[model samples]
Target: MARNREKEDVESRFNPPVSISMADSSISLLKLISILIIFVVGVVIGLVSSSHIDRYFTFQGDEFNFKNTYFDTEQFSHDGQKMVVNCDGEDCLSMESFVRLRNLNHRLRDDELFWRASFVPQKEELPFRRVPRVAFMFLTRGPLPMLPLWERFFSGQDVEKYSIYVHALPGFDLEVSNSSVFYRRQIPIAACRMGSVSLVDAEKRLLANALLDFSNERFVLLSESCIPVHDFPTVYKYLIESIHSFVDSYDDPTRYGRGRYSRRMKPDIKLADWRKGSQWFEMHRALAVKIVADTKYYTLFKKYCKPSCYPDEHYIPTYIRKFHGALNANRSITYVDWSQMGPHPATFTAGNITEGFLESLRNNGTRCSYNSGKTSICYLFARKFDPSALEPLLNITAQVMGF
Candidate 1:
């Protein structure tokens, strides 16, 4: 009897009751479920908070701020309706509609589509008399040392005939009097490095902004070093009356021209289609709009035209030749002296600003076709002028250039 009791106690110590084991198992499973539930709830709360934060920062009072960088939006009451004006100027469209039209992203593909779709064809004649205005687009790094000279060129001219636009480095503001023509003409721009695609981007950005105004019929691209070789009237008449765009485009078999052509450009751009020319060009409104709306060839150049390729020098020339050959005069209206054998053209300084030199630029003995006939009045603007030449240029403007 004693041995039987001892064996039974040993067995009881080795194994516990099944009810107690089941109860512990149930408690452990409950704890695990509670932990999982807490985790899921926390994740849901985090996602909701993140969404709200994104919304709060993205919009404010009917204004779409692009990280507070691109455009400055102002809200005001106009005739009992809320209106938002962009940094460019007063826009009568509702803020929602304006945002929809001006919604540009960093993606070039989407932006090109938007611009192409926004283009309105002039199929019908307008009821009101439309006065065509020339858009003078200046691409500069920072301040315009030649602003005084340009101010003189535009002085006393009818405001209805011309519009001024400046594309400077981002965050740069030109300090000028309120009455100055370029007082509020700076457009939103990105940083541009010499000989890079960013330079091409800046050019396109300037064109896009000028296209916003319906009155702009002609677009002229100028640099900070560029000075008007002729007065406003002469230059205006030359550009506005021209039937073809003045773009320097030519076929060269040299290493610098066709040699820069890449095989990757393939079916889109061929070796025979390659061209080289000056970056400074004067284009009509139709060409300007085409350039802004182009994505097919622009993408090709942006991808294949790397360093040494120089997109600014080649892309526009090649594109114009390929697509709009007949519309282009195949010559640049901006004079640049390439006599010096180097990568860059000769830059004119204060001492070089002579009446004879100015005369040479005006009629450089080179005859070209203008309006289906030949004319020697080739260049309307000369570039690569140093800042020191501003004073001399201003002095000779009235007598030689005839402003």
Candidate 2:
């Protein structure tokens, strides 16, 4: 009996109690399930927090996210009337309405920024239905001496078909009759010097202002010295109906052309991409928007194309050729007589404003490629007319120039 009792005690010591083993296994499973539940709950909470943070800012379409860039989401709203952004067919904002909402106190130094901020990338194409008009943008220094001639030209035409925006020097005021076409048409002015980047800025400003009007389909950059050689209807129809824009883009490998290229402009503008042309451009609405919204090429030109380089002459030509070559005819309708000596074109005085001279300007010039065919009557306007020639122009415009 003593031996049997000792054997039973040894067996109890070697084997573990079944109840304690079962309790330990159940406790381990419970611990693992609790850990899993905590992990799942943590993940759910993180997802919900992130979703709420993203919801604080409302993104407009996929293209525009003006939440925190230049404007605040709150600034876009006022007194419960939420600002509605209407994008045109080209995916550009209607600048008229946009400017109204913008904080004028916080204007940026870069005008191009305004245009870039207003750009909205279009996703689905919408049906386009708007009667388009021409925007005759004039870049001038002070008074438009040829206003009388322009008044005669635009006299009988429907005002709805065309719009005029003039950019002049600041603080230079002119007496404009209410009956005149240029009356009350001057836009906000900035000091612009010839052959400077300021000229390009003024040009872009004019374009930006005209873009506010959705009806403007064509943009023609003109000067105070410029006068329409063709009548209002004729010039309007010619510009609006044309399939390609009239921009004089040519490769001048000579001293004045390729020599103007700055090495700093490289990586963005290569030597092969160098171009030169007339500053005056008549572009379709699509190209005009692109010009206003461009920051890349404009910045390059502003830094590189300077005094002798002439940004006004080089910027548009190189930009258009590099990107929108197919949309251009590579010619300018404005006639400039560079045959005379000096940097300036031949300026026509009162003595040179005869009917024959005007007629020659109308149809007697070098042949140019128009609509894929050569034409003799290519010039639609002429430049560098003396202020004194205004009366002579007025005298002969109705009889000879057919204005």
Candidate 3:
């Protein structure tokens, strides 16, 4: 009996004993199961993340739908330069043609065929943010009645980190008094007609005028009439750093953007050169400079991006499509309510500007769950607000800025 017990005790000893291999096998099995479970969890997380990345970061051309409706009659320049333009925008001269302009003309007029550097930032200068500075380019024909609201938003600390450029109408004669933050900041501007070449010219002029001194990394165009739906800092970061711009559109040809300015552009004057949209837009600085200083396309656009044709709606997006198609965030940030088809956007009446409406506008047709805040889309500013609607907006400025 004693000899049998001794043998069993000896067999049960795992350390350097007969059962060592069995213990090792059990340990290996547990490790294998743990590894399998961890891998499955990792794959699930990766799949979900990838889906979100694909949805938001990926570019979709749906928002860039503007097209040329018509072109001008064959015409000549003041120097007897005959320009026979095609009305069908499909005839647009390739953007490659402009490459020759920067090389040849040295200024789009040079053989190299390109405009002077307008929005390009210096490589050495540190960006205003670790990302970029947002240039709030305000296009307005009236006083900034909401200056009090704007003043509170800026709040003074590190103000130099950002830039503000106002394009006020030559007629408005906006005073640049010390009392006015806008004082001395006004760039030469013109009144915009509903559908006119003057509007395109004005946009270009604003680009040119803004480029003369300020060289921000990003350019955000806003109307004087528009108001911030969120805090300035929050909106500022969004406009300057976010890769996607807020101009909205679906893929439907009927509903897509109307940018059609390629053929109407001068040397090739085809009916094809027409595009259209709201006068307001936000863009990277490189694009801003490209539009403002363009020589070849500008000449063509001047000829075809006409007042009678409503150039404001066409020029910018069309040029962007042709010249720097990839760089545009493919969106506009300013909000204009044109729910009803009409020449004018729906203006916000005091009655129409309820808290619910303001909430909706601030949401910018996007939800802001914790998971989506990084990509949460919203409009920075909204336009056509009745002077009376200003009161309601002020009441909720605090909440709007947070999300």
Candidate 4:
């Protein structure tokens, strides 16, 4: 009996109680189950997060696709109800929001993308009445010293008949009073150098911005020095009633003309197709859309047309002549004196602002056809006027220019 009790004690020391062992087993099983549950939840969360990230980042090529999705408006606000969400330093918004919010205040920075996106055709006619307004686009270096004259010209005119757009250098602002016609008229501009494609780019930028307003039926390219030769009524009646766009396109066999043509502009633009014209132009809406939407010819000129080959002087003329020749009047409405025979046109001064000189400009002995009828009123505007001419112009604007 003593030996048996000793063996049992040894066995008890070696092994624990059955009840305690069963309790430990239960705890171990519980721990395993908890660990498995935690791992499964972690995997599920990771998968969902990855899917959301992919959807947010990827932009599929489809109309009204993920590219148009906007952030929650409650969290982000800009320009009233719309908000421009910045994703990796890019503006992203839905088509609905973009159309509602897009205006002159918003800048279209990317040239290639803007051109491509804006090239879309309006298949359906406008749903509302479009009052045709002339868009006077000014491509200038900086300040408009002649703003007072323009203000006077635009003053008292029906506001619905005209719209003004100024394209000055980037970071340069136009100083005009709240009551002035040029107030808040500046558009987003790019840096432009003389005798470069960038000048053409600036012009196109102006056209694109003006094209934003569906009511703009005519586009006139102007400079800081350009002034109205005729009254506002005469100019408006001439342009608004015209059948053809006034683009100064003519063939010149001289070195300045055909010599500027490059053999590289072959197949697409032949020597016969090449023409020259004034940089200043007044074009109809149809032609304006064509020039803004063009990429094939623009690329050619940007690459081949260089210093001597001024794209500003040749690109529009040649392009219009080749494609839309019938639509153009083949003349510039802005008169410039090239008789001096230099790299630049003659710059008129305050002394040149005389009534006789203005009369000659209005009727320059060039009986050009206006709406298929002969009219002495060939030039509607004149350029290269010195800033000093502003006072004299304002002095005689009422009596001589008739407005």
Candidate 5:
């Protein structure tokens, strides 16, 4: 018996029993590894599922009644300049164009683009003539009364040569004929009251919409009251070929100019930089892009240039003068007769319509310097024509305006 006990004790010492704590720890480790693997698998599956869903929607343009809408990065590249849709499904150019324009609002808010508003580098000159178009932006309270005249003006111009964008008052319906140039070209607009920050906002909104078309080389801001004084060819040649933009920026010692400067705009916009001019303007693509991208000067104006300041008159003039003074002609091409005015310019009645009056606005019996020492016709547009004058003007359109 004693010998058996000693042998058993020796066997026990030689081969130690497994520990309970160690066994529990090993099981726990295995369980943790299993859980981790399941989690990883779930995450991978989720990502793949999300990707599949995205692909499904992207190619399902046909499901939404869109045709010839195969996905191509080329169409949407760089502000959608080359965008085309051969739609057998829906009229993509009508509502979809606005969608594309609205999408640009998101890109405009990008931190990189918004902050880098000071300047953009010039693109390399290509051998091919990628002739860019002009965007004619009309800001109106409702329907354009001058639509017939504008239609006559735009009749012969190629469809690719220009684009029209309108910002009418929200909820104001405009009944336009399908043949009208301004038809279905309205952008989503916020409320805009004249002589307020809203007016500046409207201008910016117009510019932003125009900037979406990378092919738009120039932008012209027109009011409902504005009318073309020059023929389409002459107007196109003057605006498209001109090196400098037409933006009147001048020092006015009068109450309407320098006196309108707000003390709150100090440091960034000083009294020296404050200027006043007609709200009508025409700018090259570079300047237009800069205007849309601007936050520094725009923010300052929004904060300080209230009703008394007439922000529309001062904001653009001051901003362009401060940063891009050299690029402008320092005079508005849109003529306004401020001589007979209260807060507005003189409005022409039907009786005021005449060949001699139109000629006078175009020539004014004097020459203005253009492109540095080259004297030429000064004005391109005239404003504040009454709606009643449309017929009388149309009566003489072909004979007087050469349209």
Candidate 6:
């Protein structure tokens, strides 16, 4: 019996008997309370963790396209609206009622849909119609302050097809008139401070918003100070009828040319690797989507890109180089004198703008044509013009610039 008792004691010490008996209520109740406390604590912890996780991925007010095009979730409240704008098919009744449509991920599988796209296109290839209208997007700080000169250039019989979008600084109450050429047409705008990446942001906002309502096919980003070197029809024919568009990555082995991609855009899509030229570029609607929807590279740009390095000059060209370099003719259409460096291009003075200079500008160099219709790579516009230089440009527009 003693031997049996000793073995029982050893077993009990090694593996204590669970006192989960109703008769032993005190210990059992204590254990039940402890278990309940533990469960409650776990529940609280789980709830907090769940909330934190949900908030992590919650969508902010800022939107992204389903397929990186202009189709935003919030732009249209109702369904069945037609796509009034596109690169291919002429402005006609769209089969899909834009309001009823919800798919943000629509991508074309056909080629030739974008005339010259590197990626997916629509199945039903649309033919090139009578020269497509080009939208000249003038990104400015507003008032135009020089609208009268631009008015003379834009107000002609052949200018009916083309449209203009003005992106101005947010605060200024733009001096607009009912009789002014800019009546009733203010583009969706974001604010910008000079010599900042916010300029790129403003440009993107302008493009994306215009993509919603405008029918103009080709997009040219012009500044408030820009002036037409040629007429609207000539510029239109130059781009549409040309074999390729002018979008380039100005790579200089001796120096960095692309200013859009900042030093911060590295490891994922570095400035050096994804380099592009200047802020002034002519882009197709298709390329615009790739730019705004570029999370892979753009996110990196947002993190590392800063004010000092001038990412605006480099990002666009670098991205185009990586994704759509081939679509471009690899040259910029807007004329700029880059020989003088720093914050901006050389501002043209009135004395500098002469009839001879106008001729030189109108026939400065040959442009590459994708249209197969026009001969020269027509420089649609030139920029960094001083307000005073406006007089000379206007004086010679009839002779040199078709407008």
Give the lowest summed-lDDT range of ten residues in model 6.
97-106
Per-residue alpha-carbon lDDT of candidate 4 for residues 166-211, written as tens digits (9 for 90 to 100): 9988889888788888888887777899999999999998888877
Whole-model lDDT, model 1: 0.82
Writing each residue's lDDT as its tens digit, candidate 2 over 111-191 gives 644464335437444345456689899888788889888888888888878888888898876569888777767776668
Better of 2 and 3 by lDDT: 2
Q: Which candidate is the best by TM-score?
A: 4
Which portions of model 3 miss their true places by more than 4 Å? 1-132, 176-179, 189-194, 213-215, 244-275, 364-374
What TM-score would every model get versus the actual structure?
0.73, 0.71, 0.60, 0.76, 0.73, 0.64
Q: Which prediction has more favorable lDDT, 3 or 5?
A: 5
TM-score of model 3 (CA atoms): 0.60
Question: What does the lDDT read for residue 167 in candidate 2?
Answer: 80
Considering every candidate listed, which one attains the maximal lDDT? 4
Ranking of predictions according to lDDT:
4, 1, 5, 2, 6, 3
Model 3, range 199-221, lDDT digits (tens) per residue?
66666665554443343566667
What is the per-residue lDDT of model 6 for residues 1-403, given as tens digits with 9 covering 90 to 100? 9999999999888876576444577878899999999999999999999998776656322234322343443445476574334323233235432211122112422122122222333554543333356667778886674677777766754544666667777775555778756664565455677656677777766565444432445778888888778776677766665555577576655344444344555566654575547688888766776775565665555566666546677667777877787777777778888778775688888989877887777776664455544445446677788888877777777876665
For all candidates in order, the CA lDDT equals: 0.82, 0.80, 0.58, 0.84, 0.81, 0.63
Consecutive 10-residue window with the lowest summed lDDT within model 2: 99-108
When sorted by TM-score, best at the front, the candidate numbers are 4, 5, 1, 2, 6, 3
What lDDT, from 0 to 1, does candidate 2 have? 0.80
